[model samples]
Target: MSETINTPRQETVTAGISEAKLLGSLKHLFASSFSVLGELMQNARRARASGVTFDFDPDQKTLTVCDDGTGIADFQNLVVLAQSGWDDETMLTENPFGMGLFSVLFACEEVTFRSRGRRLRVSIDAVVEKRAIAVDVDESAPVQGTRIEMRNLAPNLLPAKHEVPSAGIVGLARYEMVEELRAYAQGFAIPVRLNGEDLPRPFAQENIPGEKTDIGFVSVYGIHRAPDRQVVMVNAHAYNVYFLQGLPINGSAVRNGTPCVIVHLDNASFIPKMPDRAHLYDQERAFKRISTSLTELVERYLVDRKAKLTPKEFASRHWTECKVFRRLDLMNDVPWIPASLFFRIGAILESSERMMDRCTALATTAQGDPEAHLLSREDVEQGKFRIWRNTPYAPSASRAAALLLKVMQREEVLALADNLPEGHWLNLCTPDCEGFTFDVHASGCAGKADYHAGDWMSKVTIQLASQAEIVINDPDQRMTPLRCIVEDDWLLLPAGFTERKAFNADLPFGDHEAVCLVIGRGIRWDHPVDALSSYTDENDEYRDDWQENSARLWNALVSGLRGDSIADLVATALNTCTEVVASECHLPHMAVVRTTLAEPGTRVRNAPRMEVVCLQDDAFWESFAASFDSAGDTALKQRLRDAFVATVRPGEIIRTAE
Candidate 1:
């Protein structure tokens, strides 16, 4: 009994398919209903089919696809999932998953395959219920080819009932099906036809000019055409489209300033994902290799072109690519900086030719070459000689200086002021003026400037005129000057001013003009004074309060400058008063006295008051009640009401201010 040993029994088990999983997969197998066309087209191409025809019968509610391919010998292979019934050559060259027919069944209620004197009809309901589909003998079937008919298509696959037939097309057919055929067969190998008309088809590689490499046929688009036929890579659209075996694969092409390059895999080693086969399989490593090869190909072309072309020409052609690829060595003698890094201020000129002409390319601080001219703070401050400036339009001079100097060394500069205090930084650059401070004291603006010298060189504190508003012409105005307004100055312009008031406010202004001193402490020569280039609240959308105050100040300045009376100012104020009554008070009709009451008058000193006419409608009353409730100033609201009811019909409420 002690010597007896119990033997443990072991049975061999293999992985089994789950019925529920298979049915679930059938439901979500194809990404798009249009994928059915692609799957069928793939089958036809892999079978070495010369031509495939698709015919739709509206009366029978069937779509027939007849292909002159090597017909199916064994009907069972069509029913068996993952069992491709193709020759070794087809299997080796194009990986087939044998799951394509399921896409047809999924899209249609019933499917019939007639090939090699045998016919098989499979119902989608039967497949869903896991029922057996039987193949039958058919003497009328095509002897050496396959003919498939899909009947009772899914609702989404049906043709539009009330659609106008396209040009040259004669029957009621799904336009979507036609479009699907066009997209899938555009780069397919075999010719495809619909309703006796040949579908337009072209291999992606054949249409593009590219060289074949070990991985694929690489083609570059968005290339500039030079006079000497040299490579120009500026302003190219990046390629996001990818192809394998003349079929498109889903790949994201990042769009940037770089050149767009398309890749069509010519090598047979590529494998597609199963089922729909719209994307690559677990070929990440293979794709990485392909990308590496593509990089090499582009690099070789650029390197070869660089040697033949001048440095300026090369930089002009492939600056974006060189920066991306870190091949700046090719730009050795190029004396130009990127326009985006510099010239976007005065004019919106983006042309490389214009940028080169208007700007002098100086060496970066890193290069201490004897011939290199490094611009100091004084050079930029003087602004007498034209030089390249950063285009970011940063708000403060310090921030802009930091942003530029972080990338390349440059001098901190200050623009000279037309009118300043005796000891202003702009006025005195003397040795004793190193630590001098200038405080700006003005109505509607306040700022302080401190000057620093020594190791930091010259640090000029920024003095922004927070309340100034003025428009100035941009610096570089070759073709046409780009209009720019200081953020605060723009805010000061009356938003709801009448045409007459706006015209009265339109005074002459420019960069070098004395308008800077009038608006704020002084002008900012470093960058544009737009709100975008300055610091402001991200959440601040509307600044309604600034309108009235800005208009008043602006009128005062304009009046003082012209030595005119307050007529224009009063007109502008009247316009603003009318706007507030109509827009804010929601008065149906409002009028402000435009003429002066004291114009050769006997006793009138000012315009008496504004007038508002109330409508008898309930909507007008509701708005009137809401305006009263929402207005913050009760006294103003009472005054508005007194002014409002002076003119009214029989049903309207009336109140006389007197």
Candidate 2:
């Protein structure tokens, strides 16, 4: 430490330089073999090097770098560079902080420098002595360039065997993201090679997951600019960072993991870097901005790439994203842009006949045809890999889903009824059965038979022979009575069943996932709560959206109630009710409403039956017609009435609450 002179007459004291500490600081910056290469490459680039080459020998555990650049005239300047700062005097070495070449020697056990008919050999001990470095000059003609040979590198300095890439050189512009490198390496004159092959280019984050197959001693030759960079996938695997034609820093130097080699094309332009050139200095927030910009660019690239797709590719991607991703909006946007591009490209992208085929395939998949699997397989064979189709996301995706839903259904659904009172398994809509009972006392309704008299609820009794029964205890939340009925067995299959609310209902509790069963009937209801009107007043100001949604829901319910009273209409009502309940709220509903025709003042008898209503299509009708042929007249009529059902058209598309 320098002592400050308090007295005017006292002379100032200065601290002497610690050579050991000075060299120690620079050594850590180039600890690894790749990091050492990064520092050295910069020095070569600074010398206006037109080309660089790297040679690795596994036998000797040695590395040699030769660069065709202006040669160093004075060998002693290396020692000066080893201890200088970012002053004008140090700038004479063409290095900002003058540590690059010195650190390269620090990382290696032994280093030899050959340039302009001069040779110098350096070791840690020789560098510490400052004068022991061996120098020999033949004075014979030599190449006007520089060559560095390093051996016996520090422990863990070189990449592990598994960490090394299978192909391309480890530390040069050899192999990385190939498509991107080829596009960006056009302007640079420095022809850098690693293991004799060009380096790979950068892939975006999403794409990087797919490139795990190529992970290893990664090297890259070039970088795509912003928008293009955004399109590439992000590789989470360890990677080496290179700036311009040289590596200024590596991801491992700052943090360690399966290191992600992050290369920035013009990082130096906007990113603040440390003086040692080892890392981006205090630029976490800045890096986020770069990441965001790159992400947006990637999105742009995807849109552009999509424009050039064949109809088959477009349809395949659409189906994959939609069926697998369950993103209909995304699917809608994909093909439209590609179609416009097809026309612009003179319709050469795909034939008109192919478009029809793609549409047919897409329609078949949309219609729930298993043959759609074949179409997706064909798509995979054509270069566009689909995750949602043939992969686990395909029908196989249900395996995991089934396992998960089994546990969830047991806990969330069946177990939920455990809280309900015993024998209180029927909904309000189900009439009192001879064997079953209801907790009308707990419902706050035993005192008044007239309570909720006209407004009744439908009770659902699910019977699985081997499993415990599930009953709808409370039919509607607004009603005071806690209704329940227990009844038949249906093993809820995991197929064609979802616990998702397919629509956004404007009603309360509409956002909840619909309780759908696989092998049995799913419950749905629509009963107007005479009391709910008080919650929504005519004078109260409501948004147009709320009013419109309410109007639409009421219309659908009224339309369902007004439909023909046949078995098909009954199935349609049940299906519509379930869909509405899934999207909005579950209310009292049934396939049939049995009402007695007594005098207006007289009491009417109402009996409730919870039964499964199947929207039997023509296929089912035809299949049942033959087997139902040979039977007794009364028995056959009863069987036909129970089994045969007319098909109802699917529910219309509803407007979004969003």
- lDDT string for model 1 (1-658, tens) is 3697889898889998896578657858677777787777777877778888888755566789989888888888877777889899877777777888888888888899999898999976677676788889999889877999999877677656556655456443346666666666665667888878887654445555667788777666533212233333322323345667666676332223323556667537788776666778776776677767765665776787778876555655665666555465555445432322232222111122332353334334444432223223354345532332222222122222222211111222111111222432322321111121111222454333222211112222223344422222222331122122333221212112222121112222221111122243222332212211112135744343443343344444433343344556556666756454434344444333232234345554643223333344445555665677774555655555556665432234477798
Output the worst ten-in-a-row residue range by lDDT, candidate 1. 430-439
TM-score of candidate 1 against the unseen true structure = 0.54
Best candidate according to lDDT = 1
Cα lDDT, model 2, residue 634: 56
What is each predicted model's overall lDDT from 0 to 1? 0.51, 0.38
Q: In model 2, where do residues sit more than 4 Å from their true spots?
A: 1-16, 24-26, 58-61, 81-96, 132-136, 151-189, 193-245, 248-264, 270-279, 295-658
Task: Work out the TM-score per prediction.
Answer: 0.54, 0.38
Q: What lDDT tens digits, residue by residue, belong to model 2 across residues 419-478?
A: 112232121212221121122111111110111111111111211121223222222232
User: What's the distance in Å from true for residue 569, model 1?
Assistant: 12
Spell out the clash pairs found in candidate 1.
238-260, 346-475, 395-533, 469-489, 470-489
